[model samples]
Target chain A: MDDGAPAGNAGRTRPGPTTARTRARVGRLVTRAGLELAALLRATGPYATHDPTGSRAATRGLPAGSAAPPPVPQARLALVVATAGALHGAVMGSFAGPLGALYSAAKIPLLLGLAPLVCVPSFRVVHAVLGLADDEPAARRAVLCSQATLALTLLALSPLLVVAYASSSRYHVAKLVNVGVFALAALAGQLTLARHYRPLLRKDRRHRLALVVWPTLHLFVALQLAYALRPFVGNPRFPTEFLRSDWMGNVYLDLLWSLRATLG
Target chain B: MPAFLDLDRLLRGESTRPETLREGRVDLSAPRLVLATLVCGAVFGLCLGLFAATGETSDGAWQLLSSALKVPLLFLLTLLVTFPSLYVFATLAGSRLTLLPTLRLLVGAVAVNGAVLASFGPVVAFFTLFTTSYPFIVLLDVAFFVLSGAVSLGFLSRAVGVLFGDAAQGGSQGRAKLVFRTWLLIYGVVGAQMGWLLRPFVGNPAMEFVLFRHRRDSTIFEALANLLRDLGDGWR
Candidate 1:
């Protein structure tokens, strides 16, 4: 599972290809890139109203009471979450090998998609208690939008990950870079959630409370799950495993110990 | 987590607004408020105890446990000691607020305090990881406590002002506020003393694990002064 090997072979094979074969390969790559870009635009489009199932049209047919955008279909949003998550995860694990890439690709979609599922029931109860139950559907959509935004942001950031992995074989540096990217993406997601919740907030001030509480709950779960889903960068010294043996350890405590070792 | 939403409303001034307080009670669930306080307090306590856990001591785990338990205990016990006096004086000051509402308000304030402390958990943990200096972590945690203390007091005083702000109770409102101000000072001192009694929250590497340190001759203020001096010496 040597990551460098395939790229090294690609470099060595570049000059040996005949000119006609090179042109055909380049044409295929161009078509693939075009399709990927279209998919990305569809995922990240701020006003993605082109619902093929006519559900968004049905939403519009109802006399609109608020200026909030129509909710994207749950299935489509789930697709975006999984696809974008896997794209970023694949690059994140590229420093390991194909198997490592597959494992991470699978784990990231779970991270992006499942963490919110874990949080939704409690959040719904919170919304009900706050007397904002009527707005809960919109709030759930906001959450979905935020998750989609986070995944798309990560997908957008995968190139930087590639650059970072190329420059550093050091696992610690790789981990740090991954952290920086995720933090930036999470910030984007929070901002998106806030923006989406703004319409609801105007209708009811209590939505403001849920806006802050949701992120706090989400990040608490997400961070711990990330800690459990360790070995994302696959330290070169160790075998490329899906998780470390002691994956269930407390993340905050582990972070403290690591920091002390590094700085003290 | 819903309990945290109650704190969110408190911090946002939504729950403590003049209109809301006029209804004669804060909108906080009693059980949730207590749960939030304990969880948030324990979260910060875990962060605080990280210094010891990462230090050259075998009592690291015990330190975390003690610190977690002591933090909530420190705040709740301090409130228990000081609340009765505040309630009596507030009533004597011609306030119309009764016992249950006042207690709920104070508990809400403590939950806010806990929330603020928990938010700073990561920052404390970061510093804990970045430095092995015992004095520095102690001082850092003290500074955070001071900051959170000010926030909780601010919340309490504002809510009390609105609670006492009835047009008919104009003069007594000022008296109630004055009582609150005086009680704040007492609370601060008692909190410090209580924290001192619950010592070893951040386990010292030089010491072994103990639930309570021996009753010391020195006071909390003196210990703080010593920590400040020691921290300054380390810097130099």
Candidate 2:
């Protein structure tokens, strides 16, 4: 019986062809997913052609300069950027748990839906005040560029935010750090967009006004929209609610109060 | 050189030279030193536990285990309670040190305290063997703890002074001092509460040893009052 047991164990321990085949299949799937992700990031144009001339050349359907590659198509670029934004929001939301992910995922759509009604009109009014008629295309481009830059910046900073969230046991500090990271990313994105808008405003002396006005207006609208779509990152103080019952309370005030409580 | 040895030098105020402070920076960053510090803390805690269990001959081992465990737990709980506030206050005071380095400073201080406590262990053991009076033993243990804690606090203050010397010299010196004092007070209060929560560190010989005494009406303030009353009675 003992002699047969050794042989039986040897027979049972043989690696089957199915195991090798399954491993190969998994390897292929992972490679395919990675390639697709790379392609998606490339199409979004975050780290793409920083040369404005390249993008202008692409818009004119001309071959780009030797120094710069052709720009990605605007619609495809917009879609990818929006996707990145949603993904960033989702990752942030996941920090608070499952319900937070859902709340955060809804933020991108909320921003987009409100942009037409809020940001687009604000841009139009600014353009109109400056007497820059028929510059709707430029205005739209600026808006789109700003959104893309913000999304890309947030995506870039997501890893740091995730690390900070994961390492800390305290919910209050994590939430405060997350908010600080977002604010810093947003400020950086706005600066990038401001640089893009500078070329368009070269002829007008009052173009400087657009810089101040647009960002200020955008910030105001964004804050309001954020308040209305509360619980982007679920507060540990309260149970996960899809929306806060009261939108009247200011985030800054709440933050101060939380800081005080935490310190005490 | 081991970080704790360097720490001991710093605690003695014999090595305040800028280069020495910079060299001691490795203490906070080195994983080996961090591990050594924690192990030292545990060992010191064990010695304290043994001293605490001296009166309780029947359940000395159990009392020892409970007291030993509470030492590290008390340090951790106090740090958790005080760290965020310290970080915020330090930032406000314009200290250049980042969070990790600041945490290292605090941990190093605790490690220094542990070292000092371990050094005192033999003296404590001698006292334990000779003494039978409960109040006298309690007072001696408290005195040792207070001495160790003060030494640790001195180490922390000196470390902070070296790290933030420039900032302290600036206009924010008053604010920095205030922050430091406030943090010390907060640490004391939190430590007392934690000690209350992790009760019966020094077991009563009259009663059986217990890992935890069910917290009844005793707040930290009440415990302090009881200790004072015992001291008064002991004098009489």
Candidate 1, residue A248: CA error in Å? 73
Q: Give lDDT tens digits, candidate 1, residues A56-94.
A: 322332256534344447788789899999988998887
Worst 10 residues of 1 chain A by lDDT: A1-10
lDDT of 2 at A198: 54
Q: Candidate 1 — what's its lDDT?
A: 0.74
Which one wins on lDDT? 1
DockQ of all predictions against the true structure, Cα-based: 0.01, 0.02
* Each prediction's whole-model lDDT (CA): 0.74, 0.60
Instruction: Write one digit per residue (lDDT tens) for candidate 1, span B79-106.
Output: 8767754654464454555555666788
Pairs with backbone N, CA or C atoms under 3 Å apart (clashes), candidate 2: none
| DockQ of candidate 2 compared with the true complex | 0.02
Q: How close is chain B to the truth by TM-score, in each candidate?
A: 0.94, 0.81
